[model samples]
Target: MEENAISGDDNTHWFHSNGIITSIDNSQKKICVDISQKNSFFDGTNITLNCNKSSLDITYLEAGQEITFYFFENNVLDTEVAIEKLNIVTP
Candidate 1:
């Protein structure tokens, strides 16, 4: 049996990485997540989240909070992905 292909904003690239919020650069519209794991999913990854009007709400976020980010790619645009959800599980 062939496995179903994940596509179109369905988060085919989903993976969990524990990290602390190193900094929040509102001016740059980016957040620096410092992953401590040597083989972390985001070891040196500087993810640039879409914080536009159409993007997910992030007003509740704060520095040093451990959050689980759910990423979903845009169906229409392959290069665009947005944070589908964020849950703060730790401080």
Candidate 2:
């Protein structure tokens, strides 16, 4: 059984990282998550999660909160790299 993967436009990616909230851009509804710790995923970097793209209800997220989530690039005509969806796993 495969898990922790998000697919859009026939493209698939993994974002099964347990990260801590680093910052929140309420203006743009973007949340910066630091995946440097918790489960070993990626190169331990930070990724920005856009609320507009997320299906999960994270309107009450705060800095220092821990969560596991999946994220994927929007892949919009190569104009820019942005998040398509960021789903936070509910504990």
Candidate 3:
């Protein structure tokens, strides 16, 4: 099963969000994503999503890089959530 598939325990579900890399904190291993699209997870415009710890190689990530990230529902706080799966979206 895909990690991003809609499956989870009774507590929460998973969702994917698309956005651009606004900033990166290599020391913290965190990537600040500027959400460009809206879904059930993000409803506001221009929200920055702090994503971290993905199976993908995030070492090569940089600002302006488009990406799709999977995260759990209700795990977001002010638009920030830990990334379960991160995939670079090539143009």
Candidate 4:
């Protein structure tokens, strides 16, 4: 199984991660997530997940909230990333 594979049978390279919503940019339809803590799926300290590219409703999201999301780079073009799922994490 690959580290970021969606599943053993799936060939797609999907990754799951949870982080605090450091900021929300409705104008750009992007949310800045802080993944600096240990256990993050990726190494970046912060990543801006594009809501426009995701299938989620960003209208209900707010700053300081924790959320878990799944994303994957386009198989055809690795540079093109998309968020497949997003959910608010409740404490």
Candidate 5:
């Protein structure tokens, strides 16, 4: 099975959100993402997640970088792993 295909217990279901990074706080380990318009996976919502350590490092993340964040399973605070998942759609 794919890494992303892994499922978790209730209240721990993983969801992926895509948007330009609005702000980042490495000290507190948090990230703020906003999607102005709703899409298939998003609802024009601003998602704020508490980041944690991941298999990939995200220390160099900058604001305005297009990214898709994967919430860690079982953790209320989403973690930003330095995964190579850069998919952009230009319409």
Candidate 6:
């Protein structure tokens, strides 16, 4: 899949978020994502997603799993500020 960058909002300090995978560091409880917009800079590149103290839980999440996340501007605390929800589908 293609990757891209997401611009954050200036007002609420939030930006656009998308679905990605928790590529590496599964043991450390971290989710890596490619927030870059499709066909934008850093496309097809891997971006480290941070998961801070939020209600969203990604413990059961595994590599290659798809997830929707929320983006915020001037917010670098957690790569994944807010996780939309989990999609469980049979493969």
Error of 5 at 54 (Å): 4.8
Model 2 CA lDDT for position 9: 46
lDDT per prediction? 0.48, 0.55, 0.68, 0.66, 0.52, 0.48
**Top candidate (TM-score):** 3
Clashes of each: 0, 0, 0, 0, 0, 9
Task: Quote the positional error of residue 25 for candidate 4 in Å.
Answer: 1.1
Ten residues in a row with the worst lDDT in model 5?
Answer: 82-91
lDDT of 6 by residue, 24-91 (tens): 56455467875434433233446556554355466767766655454443444433333333342311
Higher TM-score: candidate 3 or 4?
3
Model 2: per-residue Cα lDDT over 1-91, one tens digit each: 1235554443566444466778887778777777645343343357666566545456777888876655453332121224544444433
- Cα RMSD for candidate 4? 4.3
Using TM-score as the measure, name the better of candidate 1 and candidate 5: 5
RMSD of each: 6.8, 5.5, 4.0, 4.3, 6.6, 5.6
- Model 2 misplaced regions, further than 4 Å: 1-14, 38-44, 54-56, 73-91
lDDT of 4 by residue, 1-91 (tens): 1235565444565767677888887887878887635442445557777767655678788888988877764421221234777888854
TM-score each candidate.
0.50, 0.54, 0.71, 0.69, 0.53, 0.52
- Per-residue alpha-carbon lDDT of candidate 5 for residues 1-91, written as tens digits (9 for 90 to 100): 1224235664555545566777988876666767544544433466655555454354677777766655544443232332223333221
Better of 1 and 3 by TM-score: 3
Local error of candidate 1 at residue 22 (angstroms):
1.7
Residue pairs clashing, model 2: none
Residue 6 miss distance in model 2 (angstroms):
6.9
State the TM-score for model 4: 0.69
